[model samples]
Target: MTFAKLRVRAMMVALLLSIFAVGGRGVSAQTNAYATAFTTSITYQNIGTGTANINLTVYSSSGTPSAIPASTLAQNGAGSYFVGSVSGLGTTFNGSAVISADQPIAATLVQIPAAASQVKNRPLSNGFSSGSDVVLIPTVLKSFANYTSKFVIQNTDSVANDFTVQFINPANGAVVHTANPANVLPNTSVYYDAGTIAALTGTFNGSVKVTAVKTGTTNPGSAVGTALELQTNGVGAYASQAFPASAAATKVFMATSLCNLVIPSGATTTFYAVQNAGTASASVTVTYVGTAGSTPVNVTSTATTIAAGAKASFNPCGLAPNGFSGSATINSTQPILAIGKVSGAGLYTAFEGATAGSAKTALPYVRWLAPAQGGQQTFIAIQNVGTTAATNVTVKYYSGSGTLLGTHTIPSIAAGAKASSNPTSASPSAAGMGVGGGSAVVEGTGAQLIVVTRVTSPVTGGTTGEDYNGIPFN
Candidate 1:
């Protein structure tokens, strides 16, 4: 039997559980000072044949262990686990988790703040299948636009390792700050708050690169990381995973983007940052592909040269119409990495762009909660990147226990174009998920597909939303 391993960082069962109050406010960890309490949920899907037996082993910040017994899932099926509900995990757990499965699987993590806090941010991130010696974080802010950033790096190697983090100013490609966090234990994680870095003074927005080295040897160690950007005023937050250096490519695809799109709550817009990962300066161009009925537009960066290891920002405000909503393809003269951020209706979210697409994708979490129950809904965007039009595109929804709920077929999607589906809408499968949550799998016959999942709160003008990139089955 073959096994696949995935790692999830900052897997808190109930962060600061001891200090949290039942109905009122309480203080959380330093990483989330404004949050009253933090709970975590992990959703996973089986992408391989036969039944998948998944085992989870969590390691506390101090390297303590807790095990979750194996659970089984059928091929293409999905399931979820609320960390706090697990008997072995216990409350007040702050740690990282490793998932092992007999078959290939994809998982996503959701960190939710308690309702009493009135901070409706649900930060979402995908599990890392493997670690890299070098990782790139496209965006990091320190007191920039009233938002601050924090990141967690996990040591995936068997032994302790030291990681050197460098913050680079995108303007002149200078290293503004460097931090070396020493001796991070195996399977454990370390946290860093950009706001605490004195060197990154007032209003700083930059990119970050982390290099891992073995504690006592000259050899490089393996590591993975995730970052969260939160509003200092406690309004919203979003999370994104770092990209391995090897993941950078000349072409990147963002499945969802908006240009001042007007919705019931407010106007939504998408802004993205592209980082040149090569040694030489490069030029970048962004091409927007609107949904079926809209026009396509290409916008090239005015700053012709983006220095190596530096980043450039772009938005559709001036290039596309106000109501434009669609996908984007980024092309660069050298290898590049990109991440997209969406803000509107008192909500903020982020997702990483894909360097490649797959014929099958997995969305580990989808929900439809009524207004009385937080009114959370999920929207899935599927982009066809193949040369030919995509046909027989289908979405399969499954219950939390791996039961097949329903399947919905989408109309043919044109190459470079995208289609969206709301599981709670007209689809029968969506109806099967009434007032609850589940998982979904998207497959396209003879087509390359890239997916993004966005979860929104029902309350209008409420600061509550999050998004994560779909996991492709390579």
Candidate 2:
């Protein structure tokens, strides 16, 4: 395996469709204040046969470009499924997008943060798979107070590139900051504003190991081709997080749908930031799954190493008890990477756990429109890393022009276990499924289960969030 280690092991086993935008809203807030505005959705699926219309192009990250739009995906007769959304595109702007279809396609490009009331709906999942070079962005920040992170790079190769954006320091990997913004012309895309970098400009919190090399080969070839991480709390509107080519993971699934009984700390407390990215030093095991009689604790701290690439953030309710809510599964002998943040009452969801539970059958087609349930109210969590129990487990619901809104069967799910509900409390809402919103697909014939999709919103001390971990479709 050489050719950039087989494209970094085929981009650590697939996922990353290329996208970046600042779109509408004066870009520049989050430290001195509030800045939010970014939404890029480009979904595709058309094996081949009947109808077809796909051609989307947008570039800027330094490759500056624009012009080419022809959406019309309406052919589910044999191979169909087309989603579109690429208007204007301005704001902080730093882009790269290309979608041309003749048939054979299965794409995804998502980025959220367009609405606001208080702003608390963070969902990010970026990638670069097809045999990699360098794309391992576990988490990068600059918290001196709340939070501030924004590092976008897009060269998804076709030619020109010259990358290198280090920024390590996960506890002691060194490299405070490094830059080279302005030589990414392939599909085009570039942006680095860790809240206005000044070689870190002060209190630097990090982890961003990009490497697009291979134009002349010094090894890390292929000149860094993908990365999109947008963190925020400085004031809201910066959603998108999921850039892991190989942070390693033996198992991880710590999700919560807020069982509120007063657990406030900053949105509700349920964080589990575990990042090892291996090289040696790992050792962990925390299991906490409650409700069905509750009793599966194990995790009083002590017995958690993590130190290779470094990163730690715990509070899984200490692994159950004190107002314990639900969901927990972290097992690592080494090969680790996790993320789970669930804010308090006003609501705010943060997700990216289950580095191996597998994102919704691995990209099991899920669409959102009709406001994805209008004000927002979507829940679905299924964990069963398998050791046994997993009776039937199937969640199928659709609506939003696709219509089908039905099917929901989750009888058992023990083994390592987990099962959050919402479809009128897990199977019952009949043909209206979750009521509004739209799109879903979670299967199980044998059972290994791993699905996640939250999405609350109402504000004023009620709800507010956005979650994800269900993208697996090759």
Best by lDDT: 1
TM-score of candidate 2 on Cα atoms, chains taken together: 0.34
lDDT of 1 by residue, 1-474 (tens): 445544444333234333332333344334332334566677787877778888887777788877888888888677777665555444465667888888888888887775455566788998887788998999989888778887777888889999999999998778999989888899887777788889998878999999999997779998888887877765677889999999999999998878888777788899998998899998888888683235555554344578999998888777777888888888889999999999887768899999877898889888876767767888888988878899979888777666777777887998888898876533564655654467888888678999999888754444367889998875
TM-scores, all models, native as reference: 0.90, 0.34
Note the Cα lDDT for every prediction shown: 0.78, 0.53
Task: State which candidate has the highest TM-score.
Answer: 1
- Candidate 2's error at 196, in angstroms? 27
Model 1, 71: alpha-carbon shift in Å?
3.3
Clash number for candidate 1:
0
Cα-lDDT of candidate 2:
0.53
